[model samples]
Target chain A: MQTKRMTFPGKWLPFALLAPQVIITLIFFIWPAGQALYQSLLREDAFGLRTTFVGLENFVRLFRDGAYLNSLSVTVVFAVGTTLLSMTVALLMASTVNRMIRSRSTYTTLLVWPYAIAPALAGVLWWFIFNPSIGIVPYMLEMVGYRWNHRNSGSDAMLLVILAAAWKQISYNFLFFLAGLQSIPQSLLEAASIDGASPFKRFWTIVFPLLSPTTFFLMVVNVVYAMFDTFGIIHTTTQGGPAQSTNILVYKVYADGFVGLNLGSSAAQSVILMVIVVVLTVIQFRFIERRVNY
Target chain B: MVENRPWANFFAHTVLIIGVALVIFPVYIALVASTQAPGDLLRGTMPLLPGSHGIENYKLMWQSGVSTANSPPAAKMLWNSFVMAMAITVGKLSISLLSAFAIVYFRFRFRMFFFWLIFVTLMLPVEVRIIPTFQVVADLKMLNSFAGLSIPLIASATATFLFRQFFMTIPEEMLEAARVDGAGPLKFFKDILLPLSVTNIAALFVIMFIYGWNQYLWPLLITTDPNYTTIVMGIQRMTAEENPQWHLVMAAVVMAALPPVLVILFMQRLFVKGLTETEK
Candidate 1:
């Protein structure tokens, strides 16, 4: 809110310093995004070289394509499912960790370790545990006289993907919530206890509201990560197989552009995905920025 | 304060223990699998106990060319991963710190516009621009090279955003004091701000290093030659090949996964602090 003189020597210095980052970002990020936008309007041949302009035909074709529609629905389901499950687990873990009298650091370290491993490695770990032939989970299920085949069943595949995504996410959300819990003033909880509030009542009335901002921030970040970053796990484990049940929008983009060599459609899909993310992020900021005091 | 209630304490500790076990069991299984022999691994008869064949399996993996060209060893892939991770980590850190310093300390026209320009990149997923980005890399003749793996990822908006937030928290009086001492802008950054940013730098370094190490798709897409394959790509190739040896594959995975896991374990406190600071 403070206005400073624009001619200050240091003022231009920062802009000068920022030139490298700006140039790199433009060349790699902005340029590519612009190129993708342009290519989305043009037609391409089988070998992936752009040939001619097709205007909005790619968008029109995408809308009519049932596979794209299915991918959209699948992505929505995956994002929502992972977000909700990871948030719930994170909340529980944060509150439980808050109650510990000792060794809390050790527990926190152990719990958060999973996030340090690459998502690709996490996918491989899960693949081994769920592989129908040698996976430990399927073997255990058989030992209990029930068949658990994730590869063949759509629901099972969806569950596996969600579970893998959620497992990696718990550490991220848990760390934030735990920090928020620790920062809450102890006096407020003490006063509530003195008023004869039940434990559940005190949490609901005092702690939950205070943690809302952290929760909201986590929600936005978690959803974005789930939609975009989980492609590694999905691609490695299922390759969006078994009738493409696990095919999310990001994976679809990769398949269309790289594997299928349909650059126009892929670029169009990318544009749609970008639009959805930007719109949702804007809506989130508009609403949550009002309530988030921190 | 009320005296600690034993029953309530018991319930809490039990739940925490269960959570820890659930979190650790899969990792434990992976480690055990890594130690078993090929026959034991194939038969799926190995229990959740450590085996004595870890060295043998590792040797077989090296000799079998699981990660290298024809007769080359698996160590080549590990070296490739290390080089790639190091390049991205060092590159991202320097650029992020400089950009963050500029955005925070120096007031300029269009400063916020530039900040938002970098921030917008955070929302655009790499998958969305993979084709064009790949084409650019191809055009630059960086394909299958370390430069291809590291150059495009050097400018990370998340790191810049984080560094800016960290720099903002440093009291303004410090900078003004440095200016009063006749220190130039670069002198203040080098002598004052950089020293105070050790904690943030360490935290971001660990994070960026892990991120670089975990990359699979980009490495796979960029490198066609087996000689240049990273560990993740190597593991994927192993899975795709006929008669894929689960023991060797899992061993390679454990090897690939260990460095980052150890780094996280050691920097657990800093990791938590770094993430918490970002949201703040």
Candidate 2:
């Protein structure tokens, strides 16, 4: 709420300036979210003719609904898997690139372009690589006596989606991790090295501990990303297939609402997702506060 | 000085080289696949090298898209993507700039209320509110239109906050000096503030353009018409075929990915700055 010490004296001008963003937020964002809340409390017949007010019935049904519960668990596993996988790869690359004096920019450029690829496109690329009929991975996998088909295997489908999601996200995590690594003072590493510690020991004892803040921030970001943004990855590749193994929460809302035409349940799912986002945002902001103070 | 070990440096370089290769592998495969002849991929495992048909495949896709999938030509789809991305970027930057300026420069009623209202949008992504948002578009008759494609996605809390943060760092003496020169608020904003914001605007433009270009779910939901289908969504359409033509599909993927990737590669400094600062 900080403003200039010398301020503009205006009434209508301020309103006029705020109009465009406020109007768009209301019409597109606020209004639609309001409708989701309102509709979640009501149910309509399949014909879209008769509507009955049902208080918490949709919410109750969602808790009992097997598919919704499955989606919740799938989301947990997927978010955790994506966060760990992308962050681990990104950290390795970031730490390695930080050590390079000559090839640093080249490595960063090579690693960072993937951030621009759409999640759906990333999924398609991985899907092609893992294609059962003629993919390179499967061709190689067969030589090791293991067949790979995402279409029929639930676990395989989940793994494919997770890899695609993590692959696209590695670029983002890498940029942040690299930035984090660069910010660690070189003097600390030098001092630790002067103590005759090995390179690996110095990293673990000096570098890794300092990078924890960045790691934690990326964890929340990666989780939120996997839960929400990977909608494209799942939609493009599996469509939450192989017995709903890959159906994260956001995709389920779309499938149940748009594809299945179950308005009430979808609205309820939307409300749940909103709550999840709110919680995550709060946690993110809280961490941001600590970061600022530190 | 720390002791130098040749083995440590060599190992670090090796790991970095391998990591960069792994990162580039997927797009490399897509690039190679895009060049293959139509039946080359169907015959066996995909070719690992460039084919003689690269130009032909790209020409076929650019001039006429997968006709079986009902997608428009890649040229048209790329145009739509460009227009949508520019619209979203410009819209977000202007609106966010105005709102941030208003909040920072003026003492107004409901200022805190409006700030929190914009902040609330940070939590509600379009995916969560898919049905009702689609219905709003449908009701407004904006479906299948660029306005619907861009406007709904442009109310950016992050951009607004970024501008607000930038504006606060401007010394109060600048505004006092401007006022002494008989400059009104709008003139001060135009003459002084706008010049200072060029770098921030450029950085944000890179990030927003990529965000707009890569939009998949929103465009997928709103634009059902083949003419409005973006290349990103067009790939989905192409691959949805019972037996997707891998050659054409990879060609479309390459086209879909090229502009944004080029943007990043060319304006990497701005992109990196925009990304890290925006998230912060």
Each prediction's TM-score against the native? Answer: 0.93, 0.99
Cα lDDT tens digits for candidate 1, A52-135: 999999999999999999998898899999999999988888888898857778778878887877777777778887778777
lDDT of 2 by residue, B126-205 (tens): 99899999999999999999999999999999999999999999999999999999999999999999999999999999
What range of 10 consecutive residues in model 2 chain B has the weakest lDDT sum? B1-10
lDDT of each: 0.81, 0.92
The regions of model 1 sitting more than 4 angstroms off are: A1-16, A45-50, A283-294, B1-3, B44-46, B62-72, B107-109
In model 2, the runs with Cα more than 4 Å from the true position are none
Spell out the clash pairs found in candidate 1: none
Model 1, chain B: what is the TM-score? Answer: 0.90
DockQ of each: 0.55, 0.81
lDDT of 1 at B167: 73
- lDDT against true structure, model 1: 0.81
| Chain B alone vs. reference chain B, TM-score for every model | 0.90, 0.98
